[model samples]
Target: MCRLFAITSKDPLSPMVAIEALDVMREGHDGSGVGLFLRDLGGPFDDMKDAPILSGIFTEKGIRRLDGFMMEIGFMTKYKLSIKIPKTPPPGVPKRDIYLIRAYEYPEEWEDLTSDEKYSRLMNMRLELRKMGEEKKDMIVFSFWPDVIMIKEIGDPLSVARHLGLDRKDLMARVVMAQGRQNTNYAINLYACHPFFLEGFSTMTNGENTAFIPIKEYLISRDFHGYTGYQSDSEIFTHILHYTLTKLGLDIQTYKHIITPLQDKSIEAHPNGNFLKHLKHSCRRLIIDGPNCVIGSLPDHSLFMVQDRKKLRPGVVGGRPGMFAFSSEVCGLDAVIPDRDKSKDFQPMHLDTAIVGPDRQEVSICRQTEPLPLLR
Candidate 1:
């Protein structure tokens, strides 16, 4: 199993905090890879929240094409984060031309476009770039969203961070999610990295998704182009989230129901039985059957954790006011917030979705057996 670690703070903090937390639970993961999703960014990126940030590694040739395409499409550069590659990278890390995180000004024609419209435009752009890179082995575009940055590489978590120069003070954020990946069911593929992003939402998971193919078919069957990468079985978790919240216009609570719905008797016992029954029937293909723990962030920067129906995976959330973390183990949590109230640290069981909103206050537990009253 891979170890998951995520933290959201009222102020910008180094990704090192989360990376170090992952180190405490090092035994859980095999050091095959590390993935990070940084949102509500701080440092140099804090002011460019409105511009779409294109994050990925690119070869010399790949960046040339990318520059030409951006110019052709009228996406002017607003700001760029430059990384200085170490001449001698840590063992197992690949040499690259550029590790870029650039914020871009939208096309002049899109100035009047709605947020959703801009999201589609950015998604299409990233997909095009990904295909370009795949055809010639040039680029690996992780995320093309505003205020969100993603970095993924195959190596030990700390080594990868050092190689990427991510420990630099400029690479800070109020919300950050990192995964110390274990190659559990597939080979190492950077595109398959955790903390998958789409339309401002991002998520990463430990364990597996036994219902991958069906969920993939159902999601790709939709008109959305961002749902095409099935490189990892765990990626479906993020797509299901984007689909439920944006495409289906459902609330966050409904997300848990879609991915791990209650059984017939449990649904019947639920206060919103009819609603849940319809949900289960309509989104049957989206259910996840494996033992997994999902840590994710919504567009609003709220962080949440969900336990699988079987609750076989270990995960916990703990922090004081203005800061909170969701970790694969308590030791991981202690690494970051040692002074937090241990009594309030929550380890979600089967059918529980623990959430810490953007405000970064205490976690609010929402159990399927006793969900929040806000169910719609």
Candidate 2:
């Protein structure tokens, strides 16, 4: 069972909506309500021989191509409301912290592509990073932003566990020890991609007609047998998440959005059958600056194969300005900046600084004279 979990305040304005939406995508389901209507792609679709071309590709063909792209790949079942909050949150609570779970179903034959293609993409993505470093001297472009780069010194691993009433894990205990070695800060960025509604598949046709299996029972089925590599890296982390959530008495549901084949007249019910098109405009662009690591982990996991700045480029920069950056000098002499204005008449002195920028916008920055200790 593919799943994503998160905690958020009950406040409607809480970033939880957006975070849950992104998680639903990562779990690979259109989910219920608006999501359910969008993920279904089972009905017959209208041909696009005469449909006016929009964007770089024809709308109809674009949808068909997308369906072809992920035909048999098993993604997560629709989003599940594992835990529900009270209608009226507790007083003094600014917002409700919610935990979400999203599941994925991938075909066995296509598993290699998920892993291999991802590795290739990561290796090639270095070219784009190199170009950015050479051209955009003011910023950093990292694969794992909010997770590894824009980490929250206070509310992340250590703090979160404390809040959750769980004993401090050894991994986090070490991070705290490392934090004592230097200053740490946090920043947030939200990726605007739909996982449930893939361009490679049609959800309109599949709307409401889809089938989803419960993640718990699925975990014990044949599909879970003979799986490898999940033990390494964050895979087990997700498994642990499943156990944690289940122990908390969360509820799970299954639903599929099946697109009707184009041959049937019923397919016309879903006129466009281009779920991604709905997503194109519906996709909201967001930049958060708090404990939003749950969502950030999505890109980190998806593009896990991407190399780091030191490896991708000798002097490459990445992440938010202060969250992560590159320097010309080995120690990044430029990062250490003196109060240039403080000097009455002497030459300018550069300070040690790392600039983090997102979508052409500079957000937070990290600067310090002391060196950051290396973590094993």
Candidate 3:
């Protein structure tokens, strides 16, 4: 029952997105979920008297919302911990505001420890953490991403390892290797603009077989190649905007200018001659602020830095902006085709956000992948 968590200042100095993500975590897992304990600390809301700040902020009732969602997704709740605290003094160093308290729930066979045994181990682990000088700190507990997948088949790691044809030690090694590959892949997605992992393959050979299967090659292709137009639907653009704004601390109002030109060009190039005519004139200009809306073409290759760690740099090598797998120049078998009928095509996917690494690399943020796949 080992868990991982993150703790950071709730101030703008610390990414607001990270704090928002805490809300998501609070609303995404159940009390028994393995990773719930990792979300044990939070705070420094804009309003000191925020509801979450006062009442059952991280209460079992509140966390249940997230837990229910997880169960809906075929994962069961196994462990969790949530704590809410008041804002600390600015000068007084805020101890670890975020504490990722993980409980390693080994299989029942690991030694059916009563509450006392569990408490003892917890105290021991805490002592060890203290020895390592991690009292109230945000630390990356372990490099290994626990394989909850094992729970799907067996009760414990030992059985899972044996089932996978590896000893416990070997299994741990494999897990680390796999996690490393996943971490690198994530870095690549962040570097590339395609941050969201939404692309899938649709097979319509038979009308009955119109289903989607996650396509890895498509992701690789997009990473190597990139997006086409200034399509708002693409998640890549959002990530680019997020990373850019976060790192540069530029005003969003000014961002509209940067994007205006691209929008204008996209409108000009639309297949339909009339911009608003195709809609049967039903669409109204809800609020048109001419010229103020577009962002011109951003070069395919560009340089940028992380928000908190500006010195940490990365380069966006290439990517398509608005289009999907439909308009790819690289068709199957290296054959160049003019166009493919979309009546039988799978929808192009977009990643939610791309996380650029310290090096100039990028990777998509799909549910973390198995590290083993990237070893090749």
Candidate 4:
């Protein structure tokens, strides 16, 4: 099993906090790779929250092509930041030529378009750049969005962190998710790394996804471009969250019901049991069948943790007034916030959703039997 660490705070904090937690839980993961996703960014990016920041790695030739493509498409580069990789690479890890984080200004023609339209354009552009780079093995674009930056690499979590200059960099955020991936079902493909992101939704899981194939088919059937890649079975979790919340227009709690719906007997106990029954029947493909613990963050900066119905994996949520941390184990939480209220730290039971809102006030636990809001 892999390990997942996430922290959401009222103030900007270094991802090293999450990294330190992951290091404590290092025994749980094999250290095949590490993926980091940051939101509500700070440091240099704090002032440019509105600009789209494109994060990726590129070859020398790929950099030239990227600039040409952006110029052709009317996005002017406003500012650029690149992570300096260590010259003497970590043992067994390959070095990347360029790791870039660039902020861009949209074309004047796009100034009047709705936010949704601009989002669509960015997604399309990212896909095109990814495909172009894939053909030549020249580049890999992880994300292109506002107030977000994604970094993934194949190596020991701490080693990769050091190689990327994460300790020295000013990169900081109020919300950050990091996963120490253990190669379970697939090869160590960078894209296969955890902490997958699409639009503003990001998710990372700690167990194998037995329901992957069906989930992927259903998501791809929606004709959503971002749903096409299934490099890892866990990728479906992120897409499923996006599909349920954004595409289906359902509330957050309903996301838990869709992925891990209540059993027939339990559903019948609720007032909206009939609606849920029909929902389960219609969206059966979305139901996950595995012992998985998922940690995810929404565009609003809320952080959540969900355990599969079987509760096959281990996870704990703990924190104080100004911050919350989710980890696959209690020791991981202790590493970050040791003085946090131990009485409040509780492991989520089967089919439980633990949410920490943007205010970093308290963690709310919603069980599967809880009556969900009526779908719009």
Candidate 5:
């Protein structure tokens, strides 16, 4: 019963826009936690796009450890934006020494490496930092990537936003996704937050993944280092996306097919029926088996939402030419972009994939019955 809200604009907007929308969408699903993914960054991060930004919470000791580790790894801190928290923060907010987002220059040795190699190193660094933090409860690393910053907190959306000082204009992005978690898992592990990121792909889901174990087993067998963590059942959706795009060279459209394939006659009707049949057989383990709606952003900055056939009214996308948002309820969209034409809003059916290209001009629905763009 989690609420999902994501918006993309031609120009950067403060994260508060999404945060506030999350509040409206919250309804009864308000308190578990809040997770945010900001991409196509604006403001202070625009000039530092090439530098990798490490974002998370840090105890005083953790920050010290992080400084030493970066030096050891050859990363030089270039710029930083440490959120200002008051001595007495909002109620129920956990004690945090520092809420930090810092960008780092790549090690000189990486200058000669290919893009993929550098990405591999970044992922390893994130995992290493996460492992180090877990051992001592010193750091809570969410994302370690270029032009992206993630903030995850266990309080309600607004409280988390205020605690992080998200009202400040310095941190802004053209694309952002916020999730108000339903708290199915009560341990409150921040790592389990939605909108999980890997390499350049990110996704947030709103329902249970009935096929979680099977999908988890399949991803583990891939032996990809990035598929190592499964703190939240929804995390696999992002990995599957990264795998389909990076490993299999399949386009985003193919993702819908792999995760929610058509059966029998439906598949036989597509021009790529044979390919899809073989695909359904080969990747059956990856198909979702229950209610779910996934909202995700690709490396190219395109954003999308997909609904499980069983998920009724999972989400809606509406906005003008320069900006568009997808929300679990239209009220959330109304909360943000009230001026947009209501008639044009799209509520994707069970078989629809609503996508907004990087331009943010319009949402193009890719129905499962239509032929997905050729394999690549």
Candidate 6:
């Protein structure tokens, strides 16, 4: 199993804090890779919250190509920051040519476009760059958004952090999700690392997705451009969230019903049982069939954690007045917020969703409810 760790705080905090906690759960993962995603960014990004920032690794040739393409598309670089790789990386970890996080000014024409239009444009640009990178094998773009940055590397979580110089205080965010990956079914591909992102939704998981094939097929069938990659089964979880909330116009809570709907007998007992039954029958392809613990964040900065119906994986949610964290084990949380009230720590059972809202002021536990019809 892989290990997942996420924290949402009232103030921007360095991801190194979560990485350190992940190191404590080292035994759970084989250290194949470490993936990091940060939102509600701080440091240089705090002031540029409205500018779209692109995060990726590029070779020298790839950098030139990326710049030329961006210029052709009317995007000009406003600011750029690169991770400072350690002078001497650990043995066996390949050296990166360039790790870039750049903010870009939109095309003048884009000023008149609606927010959704601008968002679609950015997604198109990222997808084009990603395809170009796939052809050249020189660039690896992880994310393109205003207040998010993603980084993934092949190595132990702690070593990857040190190599990327993530200990610096400036690399911070109000939300951070980190995964110590243990590849089970696929080759050791960097893109297969956890904390997959699509639009503004991001997710990482700690267990397998036995129903990945159908889920992948279902998502790819959608007209959306971002649903093409299935590097890891866990990526489906992110797409599922995006589909359930953004595509289907359902509440985030509805995701639990869609992904792991209650049994027919149980569903019939709820007020919305008939509606849920229809949803389960119509979207049965989206149901996840393996034991998994998922941690995710929405565009609004709300953080959530859910476990599979069987509760095959371990997850603990804990927080105080200004922060919340979800981890595969209590040891991970203990490393970060040791002083918090242990008595209040929660272990979400089957069919439970723990959500920490954007305010970071409270943790709401939304349990499984009877599927109710959509109130018109």
- Candidate 2 lDDT over 1-376, as tens digits, reads 1112211111111222222322333323222111110111011111211111111111233334323432433322322223333545333221223322222233455356655354334323323432343353322221211111111112222222233222212111000001100111112111111111111111011111011122223333424221111211222223322322233222110000111012223223443435323322221111111111111112111100011112211122222222221221222212222222222211101211222222212322221222212110
The segments of candidate 5 whose C-alpha lies over 4 angstroms from its true place after superposition are none
| Backbone N/Cα/C clashes per model | 0, 77, 50, 0, 0, 2
Worst 10 residues of 3 by lDDT: 201-210
- Candidate 1 residue-wise lDDT, 1-376, digit = tens: 8899999999999998989888889998888889999999999888888889999999989899999989999999998989988888788787788998999988989989998788898899889999988999999999898998999888899988877777898899999999997446777789888878878788898888878888899998997788888898988888899998888888677799999899899999888998889989999999998788999999999999998877888999999999999999999988889998899998998778899998887798888877546664
RMSD of 6: 1.5
In model 5, what lDDT does residue 1 have? 85
Candidate 3, residues 78-187: lDDT per residue as tens digits?
33323233344122222223222222334344356564454334334323332233333322122011221111111122222222232211111100100000011123
Q: What does the lDDT read for residue 182 in candidate 6?
A: 48
- Per-residue lDDT value at 204 in model 2: 12
Q: Estimate every model's Cα lDDT from 0 to 1.
A: 0.88, 0.21, 0.21, 0.88, 0.89, 0.88
User: Per-residue alpha-carbon lDDT of model 5 for 1-376, expressed as tens digits?
Assistant: 8899999999999999998988887774757788999999998899988789999999999999999999988999899997878887677668788988999988888999998888898999999999999999999999999999999888888988887789787899999999997347546788888889999999998888878999999999998888977888899999999989999889888899999999879999888898999999999999987688899999888999998889753699999999999999999999999999999999887788899999888999998888778743
TM-score of 1: 0.97
**What C-alpha lDDT, on a 0 to 100 scale, does residue 26 get in candidate 3?**
34
Q: lDDT, candidate 4, residue 323?
A: 90
Candidate 2, superposed: residue stretches over 4 Å from native: 1-58, 72-104, 110-368
Which candidate tops lDDT?
5
Name the TM-score of candidate 4. Answer: 0.97
Off by over 4 Å in 4: 374-376
Give the TM-score comparing model 5 with the true structure, all chains together.
Answer: 0.98
Model 3 TM-score on a 0 to 1 scale: 0.18
TM, every model: 0.97, 0.19, 0.18, 0.97, 0.98, 0.97
